[model samples]
Target: MRKKRQDFHFTGENNMIRRLVATLREYIPSNRGYPLSVDDGFDETALCARLEERARKGEEASRMVRLREEKRLGELFEPESIVKHNLLKMVCIDEGCMPPYIVQSESMGGNAGTWGSFPCVGANFIYDRMGGKIEHFGNIQYAPRHLINGKFAEGTFKLACKIDFHSIPPSTQYRVVKTPSFTPATDIARQALEETVEQYNKIYGINLLR
Candidate 1:
């Protein structure tokens, strides 16, 4: 008798493994570039140097972005760094990328379907600025939100994300207790969006709106 294939559901552990693998893959450069191997008398030192130089150039090129990290992550802009590049591109929301389902925002987030032309929520990246399990982030909420009166709403947005500056080092992930930053979203309509944010946090485990 033929056996049936077992179906697997992606739980937290599976998701973590997927993210860890995805993160490691970034540092693994594509071998298609170098043609010479040991059989061709390749120099290990020269190859390592070439890889480093290529990675540095790639890192520098991506710094065109203007993120809120300007006040914090100035080191990444330096001429030398792999960590900076890693942090910048850590969250992969771009389409057709590896583990493409990992989302950094509502746009990249999974859709529960549409609600009267509005999109509903499905799955999303649960980032713990205290640097927890979630590695995917867009940092889109760092901007301040404006109220109808054109006043900058600070505290409400302050309830948003928690960026653990401490965990962004060579070791450790997130500790749950550390400094947090607020990613406020601007409402062009200039309406009070506190309730909206709260609901979003409660439903999707997002740091915003709560």
Candidate 2:
């Protein structure tokens, strides 16, 4: 079988450098490539590696700051009370159909509770695939402010997510899920999310969120 290109998955700073130099080469007389690099005798390849290193270091620093400041209610796959799961209580509007309060996955990403029978899949983060979290914490149609993770002067508005409970059918929640994901067209939503991911890649010049 033919081997894959070595840089096929190097969607990082080096890839950026390659694009930048390639573009410059088109306009400049440097047939080899752009002479861009750190203050050293390093070639394009070496410069690419160094740029990637600095980019990684920057990401690490930002992640550290987030970890230090972000004291959230849950960890990955683990529901922490007052964080996401239990704090997000679901009361049924359809009486005699199901219990008033919906049971959440006691363990994060394990069972994810259930809508009567069908089980939930994947990590139970602040929000599911659909903008369920937004609906979860507010009466307004959409409240995506909570999606941002950082210190904000928004004050109580940041953590306050008092939303409405849905009187949706269990069967609907089981597979179709939320109105937007079920009513209009599920395939459409998936397509939109994917298209957005593609747009993101093009904007940032990186093949991620795929």
Candidate 3:
């Protein structure tokens, strides 16, 4: 009588090898930009040789170290950062064009039980002082509510942003205040405003308000 053939089942070890191969396949890039295929099975001899070579090279990249360096000294700016930079300069516009105005006063305040709106204005005054060349000025008003712990201040003039002297360019970028003479142009305009307010009863006269 012929003996019954012994049955063989490749179970746990086979499964582990299959799983590793599947994982390697998944890790490989498949996009058109990075072509990789799974048909290249791992060669234990080649891998051992490669491991020895790599160990001898003693070179490896540390992602954490690279990240820390970037955090400390990254020169690149995010889109938001660039936008805010331009906003602070008041020169952000399409295709980098500057508005011809100077920032004068940007303040914030509000009353009880109500939020406040922001009002911004720029004027051409500084340029006129420099041989009838019209310069510009600006003012921003807003009200934001915040306080120590739980109580908000009422009707307090908080300077939201203050640019002692700001000049808007013909293009959308800010140039620093040039010359001591140019530096005081806005101050002169502000003085002129003060004079007008004193001469008249209104805080902002029609000529200066615009």
Candidate 4:
């Protein structure tokens, strides 16, 4: 029997859009896609209305783009690959708060390995924070080389999993959890990563290892 398709809905007002526009206007040059004039008068109701309208339009446009891309990818990759791509994309969405240089698994050539090999099916943090100071963070994977003390060096952290292609839907065998070492910085990063993963799994009725 063909399963009925379920529509995905946004849970609430996407405040990220508002926060992003505000942040971009501060750093991005006026000539580089942002408007030059800033509205000094703040109107909460009007702003909310405009933001809702923009979100509606943006969602429509995003759906069209996704459909086109999915159709194109369908020709080049297997169904499983497409599912993995979409799953990784959800993992990458910024929810207004995330560490810098964190990237999508697909961007790091995730799911590219051969059968039985561990594919990079998780997100990656490119750098680390030390003593609550981000400026002290380094890219080296070991301590002393990147840090003054003997403690662990903050380096690339991967939160990913291995998939068993033979597993049936809703089965625990589908995902094998691959966890990164725990550190103060990684503890914070893991919270953010898990939030997105949990939200996606709950909305889709899928079992994603947390």
Candidate 5:
């Protein structure tokens, strides 16, 4: 039988250093790779040793290449990036509240709508502000916000959220608060919200209000 070469993996420190340097070079940006900073020679040896140690700890060369590719792709474009103004909510849903009112078209009020079903009908916060502050509160009211069946679908449904205006200590008497206000409606916010809902439906494979 022929003896196999022991030098196949790495026979000495020189081989290890060579492998590390090659791997580092392959990750250089001009090679169409990730933004790995170039070595200025001062910490090269230490960095190579650390990388070799990582490799010994099961981080393979192929995995490093894959990571560099992923980093490059992420830098180029990220999947499912939020467009900021795409979020929609009118009020904050309190965690401890029971049976929070859900907003939907009157057409979806019957037993046919699945949004009222388990998991889908649960409590959710609808913030009026981008950072989720400034919650709107009041009776569940409907405005001619959008249209569905008509030529111009300007129908809207908003839930009236109950909150205490003033609470006196040691008393259960809670004064009724006036409804909170949202900013003047705009086409951009509406469009972003609609698109976000469509995206959510596509991702979860669920049918929200048509």
Candidate 6:
């Protein structure tokens, strides 16, 4: 006997992912400039040199100023964390997710006001594999830490993810499917998700399978 085919439509969560992906596509080209690598192209010496140059030019010398300056300079050098923070803010506002808050730390002394939280719910690309294992990529809830004033500094809330957005294909679709009960509701939904992933993977010359 032949099997029946299922029709799929984007669930509310999946639709949100789609929007987030779209926003990323629009934002990356102009803002990020290039793909991120293992080191994320971070160069402490170069960053310090640039900061020193700015200081010599009489730019604001506050610790927060320096931090923001580092963030701007690292836009291309350390794109992952910076890009993650940027996308998280945009997605939070667009999806009405929890607003990001600034973290306070006495260790930061007067610069505590510069730290910001990372509080998004899930990965931008999530799915369930066979045998009930859940997999995901491009998390929105990642916080990047830096050494400020010789102190190892971090935000108020910190969440970590293995993969960053720059590592994933630009055309990659975003979802939040999980195992067991949270899997796609219908066969159509499963097929749609699988097909989208496959299509983008082939086009972008990458494999997302595990």
Judging by lDDT against the true structure, name the best candidate. Answer: 4
Backbone clashes in each candidate structure, one number apiece? 6, 5, 12, 0, 14, 0
- Per-residue alpha-carbon lDDT of candidate 6 for residues 17-42, written as tens digits (9 for 90 to 100): 44543454445443257532213433
Q: Judged by lDDT relative to the true structure, which candidate is superior, 3 or 5?
A: 5
Worst window of 10 by summed lDDT in candidate 4: 96-105
- RMSD, candidate 4, Å: 17.7
Minimal lDDT window, size 10, model 2: 152-161
Instruction: State how far residue 99 of model 5 sits from its true place (Å).
Output: 16
Cα lDDT tens digits for candidate 3, 68-170: 4344323433433322232222232111112322222322222212122322232222222312222122321222221111121111111121223345622
lDDT of 4 by residue, 165-188 (tens): 577632121232343443545555
Error of 6 at 3 (Å): 78
Tens digit of per-residue lDDT, candidate 2, span 27-144: 5443346542322233445545666777677568655644532333233224432223222222222211111212231231243333333343321222333322212323222335
Report how far residue 149 has shifted in candidate 6, in Å: 46
List the candidates ranked by TM-score, beginning with the highest.
4, 2, 1, 5, 6, 3
TM-score of 5: 0.22
Q: State TM-scores per candidate.
A: 0.23, 0.26, 0.15, 0.28, 0.22, 0.18
User: Which residue pairs clash within candidate 2?
Assistant: 73-83, 105-113, 137-161, 137-163, 138-163
Q: What is the C-alpha RMSD of each candidate to the true structure, in Å?
A: 19.1, 21.4, 23.1, 17.7, 22.5, 26.0
Per-residue lDDT tens digits of candidate 1, residues 79-197? 33322322333322232111223233334113344333233332222232221212232232533122112232222111122233567532111111111232433432122223323
